[model samples]
Structures are given as C-alpha cells and as structure tokens.
Target chain A: MAGKKLSIIVFSGTVDKLMPVGILASGAAASGYEVNLFFTFWGLNAISKNGMQAQPQVDKNYEQMGPMMMKRMMDMKFPMWHQMVREAKEVGEVKVYACSTTMEFFGLKKEDLADFVDDVVGVATFLDRAEGGTTLFI
Target chain B: MSQEAKIAKTLDVKGMYCPGPVMETAKAIKQINVGEVLEVLATDPAAKPDIEAWARRTGHQILDIQQQGGVTRILVKRAK
Candidate 1:
C-alpha cells in the first residue's frame, strides 16, 4: 500500500462542498495518511458551532427538490455530513486551518468559527506544507 | 459471533447522501487489517455506483453488492 500525505485546499463557502472537504481530509487520515484541510473564503464557515446546525449549502439536487422538501430532507439526517466531519476529526489526523486572507476580508476572527479549526494561515504557508503527495481543492 | 473476533465491520448507511457512506466506509475499512472486509449497508441509491467508482479508481476491490428491498449491501476489499 502506498502511504502518502494529502493536503486539501477548501475554497467554497457553501456547506455542501465544505463538508466533503473535511470528510475527505479526515478519511485520508483515517486511512493512515497525514491530512490537512485549508479553509478559505466561505469554506471557513463550516467549522463554526452554529454552522454545524445550519442548513447545508443547497445543490442542484436540492434545487430540484425545492426548498421545503429539501429542508425536510436535510432534517431527516439522511447523510449527517456535518457529524461525519466531526467524527472523522476525532478518529483521524485531520487538521483544519482558516485562510488568513479570507478571515481579514470578512473581518472575522478565528474564534468566530466552529470548534474544529486549528489555525489561520496564508496560501503560501499552506502550500509549503502541501508540497508532497496529493493536493485537492473543494 | 463473538464481538472481538467478528472479523468484519458493518456500516449501515441506508439513507446517507453522496460521499457520506463512501467516506464512512473508507474510514471503517482503514481501521481493519488489509484482508478484513467492510460491509456497507446503504439505503442510498447512490452508494452502489459511487462506491464502485471509488473502489475502482482507488485500487480497492468490491467483493459483492447485493440489493435487498431499497437497501444495498456492498462488500468491499481494501487494496493491499
């Protein structure tokens, strides 16, 4: 088996993409790979305590289902993506970093995010850590 | 079967969304030894195709996929 470090750059603000970003990072870690998730722009919103409970970002499927129905679908705990991200972190070497530039632009503080974030850094700094293995953006 | 010697992990992900069951299965498979099998019990219509794709792309193998009622039981073998 090939063991490699995986680094993911998360740029989307919506919860839909953000959830997978975290899940994959955690999954990679659980599979015995070192994993890091860099959260930038709206993607940083996913780590907030409130974000966990908030409705996930709507997608094309959700759009077809309509808001009321989609809300119901989300409420049913079908996938429970948020909880997966949380659990994945608990069991793996997943680290979440907030993009410093995004934070500054939004006039947001790291404290404003949910409980999963580890630090705030710039792209240059994140790339330095992501130099080897696989890199993904979500 | 004795819990300790069960030799397999079962993840019931019937209603889980895209990437949800797949992610969980991947995580569970990682915990077991190389030859251990992972049985992902999913009701999600997407699990069969998505997991098959993931397994194929990642070098893992799908031992079997059985659909009963609306749920599908996908047995996967971790890549060595």
Candidate 2:
C-alpha cells in the first residue's frame, strides 16, 4: 500500500455531495492513503471562511427532506462534513487545495479561504498531484 | 490459538459510522505497544468487515470477533 493516493475534484457545494467527500477522504487517510481534495467552482465556496460559517444547504431537489435529514444526522451525533475533513488531515497526509482560478473569479484572497486549505493552486498543479491515482469528480 | 489474548486497550465506537470506527481503530492501535491486543466494541453493522479490511491493509492481526445482542466485539493485535 505504499504511495497509495485518492484525489477528489470537488465540484458541488451542496451538503449532500460534500458529505461523501469528507467520508471518503477520512476513510482513505485512515487506510494509509494520501488524500487530495481540489475545490473548484461551487466546491471552492465550501472551503471559504465565510462559507464555513453559513448553514449548510442540501440540493433543492431534496428540499422537503432537508430538515428531516439534518435532524436525523444530528440525532445520530454525526460530525459535520468539514469536521471530518479536518480530522482526516489530522490523521494522515491529506491536502486541501483551493482552485486559483475560482478564487480569482470570486475575488477571494488567500485569507478568505479556510485555514485547512494547504494551498491555492492551478489546474495543472492539481493534475500533477492527482496523477496516477484514483481521482473522483464530485 | 486456544488461549485468549490480553486486552491492552478498549475502544467503544458504538454510534459512529463508516470511517469513524476505522479511523478511531487506527488511532487506538497506536496507543498500545506492538503485539498488544485492542478490543473494539462497535454497534455499526459495517464494523466487522471494515475493521477486518483495515487490519488486512494495515498489517494488523485480528484474533477474534463476536456478536452479542446488538454489539460487536473485535479483538485485534498490533502486528507492526
């Protein structure tokens, strides 16, 4: 299992989609895999300091069940998705990258991103790190 | 193999799901010395298979597993 890696191109900001990102990242890290999370588009918003403070929203299609699902998750004592990703970083070689292009488009500075973000990088840099491993676009 | 292994640490990951159990198990295994046994008590149904796979991948050894009522008890020995 030497040098095993799992890379995710996070494209969605919705809670439903982000949950799996945290779960998979943590799981890979726990299993001794290097995990890379490249946040782009809406996913980049998810790692912003302001974005982290806002209430998490599910997809509009699941709006009716959103409240119920949130309550159920709370009842089960599940950690928030971001918390899981943070834990992943604490336990293994997990790197969270914010997309440079997205940051420029949104006029976000490095300080606006979450503290956990390892770097603000371009597509080529992300591709180089994500090469030769399991890369998922979510 | 008939004798019981001494438990050095016990981790109760009852309500957590999926990665929680395995992650905690990985962390707990490090708290004890190599060759020491860890007893994990979990309620998640995936605990058995997940921990087994974790052990296999991490090179740890699973000594025994048992289910009583709703709880699953797994005994794993640190092999590294």
Candidate 3:
C-alpha cells in the first residue's frame, strides 16, 4: 500500500491554533507520512520572517491565559511551533507552501517568509498536493 | 528475546513529548543496520501507539513493548 499523506491548510494566526498545526504536522511526518502545509491568509502572515519571531498571541477568548501559558511552556523547555516544524522536516518528507494570493494581498515577497517555506503556490497547486490525503484546516 | 533479535542501540527519550519521542526514534533507527533492533525508552503517554503507528507506516517491525514505572520500552527492528 502507498504511504499515508497529511495536508494542512493553515488559516489561523493565533498561537492557540498554530500550535496544533505544528504538532499535527510533526506527528504525521514522524509516522512516515507525506506532509504538506499550505499557509494562507493569517497563516501566511504567521510564517513570514517577521511573524515567526513575533510574540505569540492567543485567541481573544483565551487572552487572559496567554502569558501564563507562554511562561509554563518556557518553564517546561517546550519547543516553539516553528521549531517543531523544522524538526518534522528533518525526520520526514514535509513541504511547506506559501499561498501566492495571500502574498500578493499582503505585499509579501518570497524572501519575506521563513527559510523553511518550500514554494509559493496557489490553491490549485495545494489541491493537487492534498489529493487522496487527509486534509485539515487550522 | 533471542540473540538474533538483540537490540543494537537504546534511545532514551524520557521526559520528551509527542513528536520528540517519535522524531528521535526515526533518527535512531537510521543508525542501526537493517535487521538490527533499536530500543526506545520514552515517557510520553503517546509513545506506545505513536511508535507502533510509525513502525507500521515506515515498514518496520515492532518486536516488543513493555512499560514499567511509567517508562515505555519499545523494540523496533529496522526493515529497510
């Protein structure tokens, strides 16, 4: 049988949501699955050079807990979400894509994204890569 | 259990979480020769199912799994 595939469409920028993207991608990648991460809208912004280093923000509903959670993660020596993605790439076939439309909308160049981004692609390309796989939107 | 199934290396990933144990296992598996067993010692609650799933997907064989004092020990034989 062919190997399993996992595709994630990242649309949220909040740290709460982005954490799952990184964790899920890493989990699937570690399991020898092909992983594709399609970053769009706020998600595209999160992967940008500036955004990757920006302070992590939680959803408005969880704003009060953000600082405590960050502190707890720091105390536990937890890896940041981006670090997880990088580790996933090291262990498995993981491809990260930046949405072309989102880049144009935000005036972002290819270089504006984090170094791990494999390509700037459109929705059609994302669909093609995500076909016959388990796709998630985060 | 048998001499032929002896573990070649032991990867201790205790105190690590989800992907940490799995990622370490993937990397450690590469250091052993084909047919050699790689033993993983982890504390992550997900280690058992996660490593089993990883072995399944990677075409490796999981020879044994045991837990004691909250530590999980997994034996995986590299298939490729």
**What DockQ would candidate 1 receive versus the native complex?**
0.23
Per-residue lDDT tens digits for candidate 2, residues A61-82, read 9988989999998999888899
Q: Which candidate comes out best when scored by TM-score?
A: 2
| lDDT per residue (tens digit) for residues A6-118 in model 1 | 89887775655655665576556545566778887667665555555676665565565556755665686644455666666766667778888777877778788867778
Encode model 2's per-residue lDDT on B1-80: one tens digit a residue: 43688999999999888889998998899899999999999999999999998888788999999998899999999998
Write the number of the candidate with greater TM-score, choosing between 2 and 3: 2
Candidate 3 lDDT at B13 equals 95
lDDT of each: 0.70, 0.92, 0.91
- Stretch of 10 with least lDDT, candidate 2 chain B: B1-10
Alpha-carbon TM-score of each model against the true structure: 0.64, 0.97, 0.95
Ranked by DockQ from best down, the candidates are 2, 3, 1
Ranking by lDDT: 2, 3, 1
Sorted on TM-score, best first, the list reads 2, 3, 1
Q: State in Å the error of residue A46, model 2.
A: 0.9
Instruction: List model 3 lDDT by residue over A75-98, tens digit each.
Output: 767788899999889988999999
CAPRI docking class of candidate 2: medium
Per-residue lDDT of model 1, residues B4-75, tens digit only: 223377888766776577677766777777877788899878888878876764577788878889989888
Provide the TM-score, chain A, model 2.
0.98
